[model samples]
Target: MTSQTEIRVLEISPPESLDSPEAELFHGGVDVEFAIAKQERGYTDLCPSAEEVLVSLRSQKYYKKIRLAAVAGLAGAPRREDVLGWASIDLPRHDNLHLAEVHVAVRPECRGRGVGTALYSAAEELARDAGRTTILAWSDHRDAPSTRGDDDSGLEAEAILRPPTGIGGVPPDDAPTRFAVRNGFQLEQVGRHSVLPAPIDSEHNSALLSAAEQRANVPETYQLVTWKNRCPDEWLEQFAKLRQKMSTDAPMAGLEIEEEDWDGARIRDEEDRTLAFGRTSYVTAALHVQSGLLAAFTAIETVARSTEFAFQGDTLVIKGHRGNKLGQLVKAVNLARVLTENPGLKRIHTWNAAGNSYMLRVNLDQGYRPEDVEGEWQKRLQESG
Candidate 1:
């Protein structure tokens, strides 16, 4: 019901630097993200800074980035010159070329004005033109996180809807949920966002580390190796293999994603990108003593400016090494080192697919509590004949 004269959607290019004039819209988009997070989740801890967002847009060797913004100044004055919304379409370059990940965000005041729908329309058209057949998107849900530890405020079960995974649920009336369903995207999977308070008790950490090491048969058959920022030359290839496995080994549920293509070069590229974002990485991997191969690995990233929290990245135990508790072993060792080095860190945040019970259990055992739910939505586009 909106007219073209009210607003305009245009493709945007990343500014050369944060100080550039074109950067205003990009920074405005980041502000919108922070505002949305704070309004829904009561905090903006998960939102990245403008510098980080620009760094990601520039580092597109692995994924092609297309950004669009809706400007509300087409007519005369008043709300003129205001950025109403932002959208991004990411297309993988190496593997999963058939997929396009689309994200759209509108300013809180711009809701119900057709800004979001216009942005999405432009983004999806670009994806189709690029030959992408699968579109993927995610929505954040902060109300009534379905966890045993959290209370749902007497909400009825019938009002909640679970994805095909049958693990987590979101309220049917949530704005994001309704918009996605109206746009033909199916709820494919759900992920639980969790946080672990830091300054972990040294005694408790030691006890958990001992139990995990014993379960992993560490030192006897496997050894834990920890590093920061960069991987050692000797273990780069093995580490790259673990990174490759993370793509396929993780639960996909109904997503049409494929195994990612990774090499030592890609690993080094990612490390460089992390540094450019003003972040530091902490990694721990389990090395098989006899084979000298990395059987499992985990990583955590922290921003230099905010030493208050860290984000937990991928943690995976290769298929052959599943039952040995290597996941917990690497996570514990890496976390212990991170806490020691960054004494000011207050907490760590991580997300896992709702169906990934083993990893979820590992996180739970480490004292991570449920904070929110994320819905993974997917839609298949009709191929052009």
Candidate 2:
């Protein structure tokens, strides 16, 4: 007979890192759990590299600056080797300081026994203790019931992101979805996940880019500037402005997200962290030729070991600069750069608001294919529990 799962914190003092044996165990456990989750999602790839975990949670170079805390729970016992699941709260130093993002995973065999709930409870306590009132979390699943736009075969139609009403108080169909919903969190935003095959066929990609270029009729008054790792010192101020615009201008739909206050210093801090982790970043931006102002930008990140995929970060074209196809131009420029630099990278993954038809069309035109849907959930800790 299976034993009852017991959940509690796997605590380690500060100045500690996830590279420790206990952390590694939990890290490896999470990888195994992710593998199971992916298989369930019909994905064939392995979980994203454990290196990302170590870099995020264990990098002392990022300690007080980022302020990350981890907690793990065990099943039926308080042993390091018995980790049933674990969660981490990432409090980014520069932005979203008032917010904490909880990332959790449970071992495949120990799921459905409240192990995930236990980890979340522990994480919530940590957030509360840190004086954080805003908590953001996400749930991912496959084969979920499609809402209105679904075909008879259950394939979901393009969903438009709408403002959330309130916590449904209704039970969700899956354990993962229910964990957050039952805990009083409201679904704030919906995103569609898509992937673009990498090691891009240069001939085909060139054709796509040329087609977009022709259609954009990008004004002769604009020019493309590309870089790696960080923007030029001269461009940091305008670049920061674009980032702040992303917070409010991007389609949040119903999400109650506050504006992200980005500046040159914060941008520098991010670049430093990226350098410490030995990752590669590509940025492509449109410079208004005569004005010398940055009109829009797009970026992609990949680690040296990222042979399979690169994470697409942000692509934005300011309001006044819209209609120039700057979005497609910048994204296409960066995609070509990433393909050239990281020849082994075979795919690029990005998530977009379900209602973002403009950006979605841009991605589709660049050969991106829809893969899944995910929710960005939000909880006001003080109001709930």
Candidate 3:
């Protein structure tokens, strides 16, 4: 026989206790139903499964931010005792330690009974404990009405409702545009998702390479070379400078974000972390001859998990220097190398902001296309309340 306990907050530890059939039933079962309900109401594909949820919970990036919750009731009704929701809060901006990003989720069975409210309240308390004063939430709004085959808009509508939490204001339209207006969250930015299709013919690849070769001539004094061997201390210094300069020059809409400070210690730490994950299979760097300038570089790490094949992680490139088509040149060469080295690799995936047309053109010319679109929306909790 299982004992019953009161509903309260508890600090669960690693090696999650929710492993038994009863616990898995509570977690996975509720999640499956929640997804179907959301889908039926036109919420589309918004739910995350237990495995994915576990991954996010365990991720190094999110380990410090996540808060778990469960209801405590009778044994047979363990489903009623199951943790039906979760919230994660990111650390504050380095400059302003008082602000943080808050992510929230609630099980369908627990909705309307104030599960979101409880989860959000607990999140804010956690934030305050972490020395944060404000929370930002992100949600999406689709233009078309849900073709979910059900007219449960009313129930589906409550998904975005964020009542006054007293500690902070909820920005209106933090939910989708429609629900935001209906419930009170306001829209702060107009965002869109776009894709660059994969290149299909030799003509497309040739054009991309040509553009890059032409751009390479702009800085005639600089020589293009792939990054090899240990990165020299001087090279790292130049790379850091270029990184900051490009970040400051990149186009931003309305937001007054500043370039993040780069330091050698931090760079070393990141390098150590990446190496711990796996060995780097591909790295490309371009340097100037006369001034020893590190103008452009790109790195691709290949992950081989299954016997069938492999895929490419998104390639990172500094801005400003990209227009000369150096991005295309660097990426094309890197992709060709990967294909030649690893046979039977079918596809590659990458993502970019919808407004970034230049890189989109490069990827499209290289035979890449949009596989998926992830939306980003922000709401100011201080103002919304």
Candidate 4:
């Protein structure tokens, strides 16, 4: 049994500096939540460190986001020990101004006691106040070994909720799925999370790269360019274009994300943030040697805490450049470079829309194995006249 009186939801103002007492307190709460979540989800590479969270809160270069936490303390800023759950409402400022992403997490022991509900309610109120029409949230689940339905198996077909894309499904009985359904949110899309064991045999990588190049049938004027940490001045403009295309061209299925605007300044900002988080990034671009412009690009970044893990960023082959295997070319080139550079990096994790067969095939060819499925849920708010 739970009541509104038991848990109080409060806004968490971004701290002035990470060294501040407030920062330490808030970080403690946030880190605990992440630890619990990682424990429940059984994924070590998915969660970010508390320092990363603080850095994002301090700077809103891309999204105007706010955090709310459910607490049980007296009338004041809640102490770290009093936090029962937290939620973040991320409002896109540039292109998708009407969309808000809400993420909620409650302590494992405090779940089912209204902590998550209180935090989500507070976050949703903020989004509503900002006039956001489409609210999106995500839930993570372990990947099912198979999505097949057998009449003799006892599990009914209706027990699994498959996205309209016809690629992935999630059990509706799970807590997260049930919560989303109960909150009037529909499971819009399912994305496959994959992990590629790293330090891939150098010989194997070379063979794949060779095969991709042969398949591309690219002109002798096409070449591969690699960089670390920062984009070169000469390629900044074209790199920005590739990123913008990635925003619009990527398979989104039924999600309501809009085309994002990216410029050289935004790219620089992102690079700085990645460095600030103590992570190193590797970038590979498939350049049209004739035009001196990037036609496709891919990025991989090392995890801050450990060298054994990294996350694959955007991999895009711009329009007019696809079907030539530019996607595989860049991905293979970048992976080979990163694996050789980070000897300790053991695995690289990535996600793709279930329906994105092109990129999925590219990833699978590079040895990426399915690790989990994530549901992107959305709810459209009615006009609040």
Which structure among the candidates has the greatest lDDT? 1
TM-score of 4: 0.92
TM-score of 1: 0.94
lDDT of 4 by residue, 1-385 (tens): 4456778877788777767878645764586667675777665566777778878887786899798877775477557777777888998877899899999987777778877877877887888899899899998777443322222234456867877776677778888998898888888888878888866777877788888788776558578888999999889988988888888788877788888899999999988999988899999988887777888889999876998899999998878777888888888888888887789988889998877889988888888888777888888877332
lDDT of 3 by residue, 59-80 (tens): 4431254544545443334453
All candidates: CA RMSD (Å): 2.6, 4.6, 8.4, 2.7
Q: Candidate 2: how large is its RMSD?
A: 4.6
For 281-352, candidate 2 gives per-residue lDDT tens digits of: 889988887788998899998866646778888899988888877888888888888887777777788988
Instruction: Provide the lowest-lDDT 10-residue window in model 3.
Output: 162-171
Candidate 4: count of backbone clashes, pairs at least 3 residues apart or interchain: 0
Lowest lDDT 10-residue stretch of candidate 1:
73-82
Ranking according to TM-score, highest score first = 1, 4, 2, 3
TM-scores, all models, native as reference: 0.94, 0.82, 0.62, 0.92
Candidate 4 at 111: error in angstroms? 0.9
Candidate 1 structure quality by residue, lDDT tens digits, 1-385: 3454577887777888888777777776777788787777677788888888888998889999998888776643222137778899999999999999999998777788889899998999999999999999999887645644654445566777777767677888988999998888999998888999977777776777899889888798999888899999999988998898899889889999899998999999999999998999999999899987889999999897698989999999998889988888888888888888899989899999988999999998888988878899999997322
lDDT of each: 0.85, 0.68, 0.48, 0.81
Ranking by lDDT: 1, 4, 2, 3
Off by over 4 Å in 3: 1-64, 67-83, 92-98, 105-117, 133-203, 218-222, 227-234, 242-251, 276-281, 304-322, 371-373
Better of 2 and 4 by TM-score: 4
Clash pairs (backbone) in predicted model 2: 6-76, 163-254
